[model samples]
Target: MTMTVRDLRPDVRADAEGFSDTRRLALPYMLSTPESVVHTLTHAHPDAHFGQLIAEEEGEIVGTAQISVAHDSPEPGQGSANIYVRPDRTRRGAGSLLLRTAEERLAALGVRKLFAWVLDEPDNRAFAERRGFRASRSAYFLRLDLAAGMLPPRQDPPAGVELRTGADFADDPRPMFELDAVTSSDEPSDIAVEFTDYEAWLEETWQHPLLNLGLTSVAVVDGRPAAFSAAYTDGGTRYATAMTGTAREFRGRGLAKLAKNDSLHRARAAGYTEAFTGNDTGNGPMIAINKWFGYEVCATEVRYVRELG
Candidate 1:
């Protein structure tokens, strides 16, 4: 059977569903939904020049490529193209075809630095190396058996602080946004990012299909959101933390730990069975927090970079 790479069409129902389905199975730790897929296709920053591509085999979608530029970063020509094939559908020509097509699109946009994330398996690493990419930093996927593990008991906030759900700020989420901006910039990563557009945040993150406002816990200090653990669910037993961070001024206060514990407790109480999150290897403090919650490292992936000539 011949494999071919092609653009993913948002208007086609089956194609969108297949793309989302493939991603969900290949990268279970990351939350992906049909609605969120469409939201990403339409609302992504214009400067990013994002492309959603799929690799098809004998009429079945087997792999996907999410290619985009790091438009908001201070550096120019920074591009990212992450490829994921369905676990049971490897060894086909899909991965190569997807990479080639993505590189061509990125080259046309004058991309100079191309980055990709490949699973830390031997074959995946070899594939990336053979294609002129070198490994950089790596991160682990942590999972907690919410249904069976004994989560640490939730703690009361110190004076001048309180625990609250993300839903509490339904009328005004700008405070949460401000906290997110501060935390995101400080996250350990290869590419530096800045999030200043409120409207973009509303379209991309706030309106995402899996963001569970009821379960996302936030720490409030002096009536201002200072730390938070964002939640995403597939309307089932699986729950994941999209992000957890503390504002710069409040780093030493332990508000992030408080929010994450509260969120995990809520998820387990709400009948969730599994909880997933990713942590960069260099982030000792965040890794320790996940360890405290009994999350074991299930998988790891390395970021590879290629400088386009």
Candidate 2:
């Protein structure tokens, strides 16, 4: 009958399950699993000071928070605490408790500026504003129904280009990582991040439970990875494009579109029913690519920032 906020215990299966359940219920557009939840918490960078919090109400986990510092960013003292509460369990004090605890923890770690993503709904926006957070940039969540076959027809790679899956580079994924780093840097984000540590990438990204390497398509130029479409599946009907980008030198060649189309076709063939992705509102190129593939905007979320002394 009382709601309490505490750290998530990955060792306890119920805790992981409940945390994942609450996340999926709160934000179905993104993929989340118990294994991914544990992996992220365990493998985060030391500088990140990552923490996962769960709000339990009489034995049910109804809210969750992902708290972490932007360690990879060139700047210091920037942190994030994204809190999500179950829609059916609204009006409870779970969000407030989680936010207070997360802010305190990050502040203790010397974080100065805090950011959070709030669903672009009246109640959610009010909650963030009430906490002294101001609305910032926004992103749109898009979805594609694979069963409908609305995806663009698969096309052959251009001359001297080869299409491959992320699994093809499993023996050595450094190439894929290199391509990812280059492309990720070009993405539109308030926090600038650099993927400089290969081992950390392997531990935190390449080994993530939801990443389906077999379905992640890559565009190779003369045997080098030039573009990629990263895929993450929920081990079920849902499939999502985590990131899709082309190297700077490979832009304007349509390499990203090639990789993503191949990946989506393969995913549909593999029986995935729903596909999801998100793009910042300012990212016109990526949004155009998603539209070309029949993806429609389903939901939106606005980033909110607050200063912490």
Candidate 3:
């Protein structure tokens, strides 16, 4: 069977299903649904010009790529293409074909540099480098078996600290957004991102399909949100911490850790068997916190960059 590549058609249900399926098989740690996929494509910032590309094997979708420009970044010409082939269907040149097409699009858009994330495996890394992509930053995907792992005992709210769910702030989530912006700025990453646009945050983040506001834990200090652990579930047993951080002034008090503990405990009580999250390899503080919670690195992914000539 001949392998072919083409743009994904969101108007067709099968295409969306195939695309979502390929992604789930390739990256189990992340969650994706057809609705969310379509939403992302249609509601994406105009400047992003995102492309949902799929690789077909005899008309059957076998691989997928999320190609988009870093439109919100202060600098231009930065684009990203995250490509993945189904775990069972490899070595058919799908990745190579997708990368070739994506690089062409980026170059045509005057993108001077391209970034891609390849799984941290011997074969995956070799493939990226073989295509002129040099390895850059890396992140660890951590997993916790909630059903069997012994979790920290949940405690009552400590003195002067109150616990609240993200839903409580539904009428006004600007505070949560403010806290997220502050913590995200301090996160380790190659691209410096600023989340200053509150309306954009509400549209893309607060309404995300996987966000489990009920399970999200926020630590309140004197009446203001000081720390939080955002939750995202796969509409099943898999639960992931989207982000966990403390306010700059509230650091060192262990409030972030406390919030995450509360979230995890509630997740386990809710019958989530698997929990997953990713942290930059250089984020020692977050790595230590995950270790303390008995999470282990299940996989890794490395960023690869290519200079567009």
Candidate 4:
């Protein structure tokens, strides 16, 4: 069997479908679609130098990698390379070939520190350790069966607060962007990211193919967005929370929970049966809120770092 790694052709429908299928099979807890795969490649910031590679054996895609520099981060020389091989097609040298290609590409882009997420399995950890990558932080992929799970009863916002949907901000989404920027800066991660470019956010986030504006819920205080839960759907039975956060000044009031709960109820009503979300283990408050919503830790992944010369 001939194994080769090459850059994905965004215009090719087969390439996108193959890439998305491999990712869905390898990481079922996360959502992926052909349209999303194309959107990510075309809408990424130019400075990010984003590229996606696919490892093909004969005519079938066996592995895929998404590589990019942390252009929005204040820290330079930081990059990410997430590689995944079809579970049924591993051990055929696809993973190693894809990693080698990813590393070479990232190194040429001036990456000094590379980061990757490995599933918390013995074999996966061993593979990273063998490649000189050391584990740093861990995160959990939580799942809730919306079909049978009992969501908290809907509640009325406080006297000065009101519940709104992302669709309500269509005429002017600058407020949602502002709230997202403030909350994203506080998220726990090895790399600190700043969302300074509103246009970039609009292209890369707000306008993404999976973003479900009608299902997303926001908490508005005095006509300003204070907290929000961004929802994404596969347009099928699966739904996910892209992000749920509250403005700094509005913390400690359970606004985040309120927004997320409202979003979940809307998702269930829209016929989404499964809900998935991820959280860093260090984020105690968000973890507590997910647990309160009856979400269970379905899987865990550890972030690994490797220094490049």
Candidate number that wins on TM-score, 1 or 2: 2
Between candidates 3 and 4, name the one with more favorable lDDT.
4
Q: Candidate 2: where is the Cα deviation over 4 Å?
A: none
Q: Which one wins on lDDT? A: 4
lDDT of 2: 0.94
lDDT of 3 by residue, 246-272 (tens): 999999988988999999999999999
Give the clashing residue pairs of candidate 2, or none. Answer: none
Compute the lDDT for candidate 4: 0.96
Off by over 4 Å in 4: none
Across 43-67, the per-residue lDDT of candidate 2 in tens digits comes to 9999899999999899889999999
What TM-score does candidate 3 reach?
0.96
TM-score of 4: 0.99
Q: What's the candidate order when arranged by decreasing lDDT? A: 4, 2, 1, 3
Stretches of candidate 3 off by over 4 Å are none
Please state the error at residue 87 of candidate 3 in Å. Answer: 2.0
Against the true structure, candidate 3 has what lDDT? 0.90
**Clash pairs (backbone) in predicted model 1:** none
Q: What is the TM-score of each candidate against the true structure?
A: 0.98, 0.99, 0.96, 0.99
Give the range where candidate 2 is weakest over 10 consecutive residues by summed lDDT.
148-157
Candidate that beats the other on TM-score, 1 or 4, i.e. the better one: 4
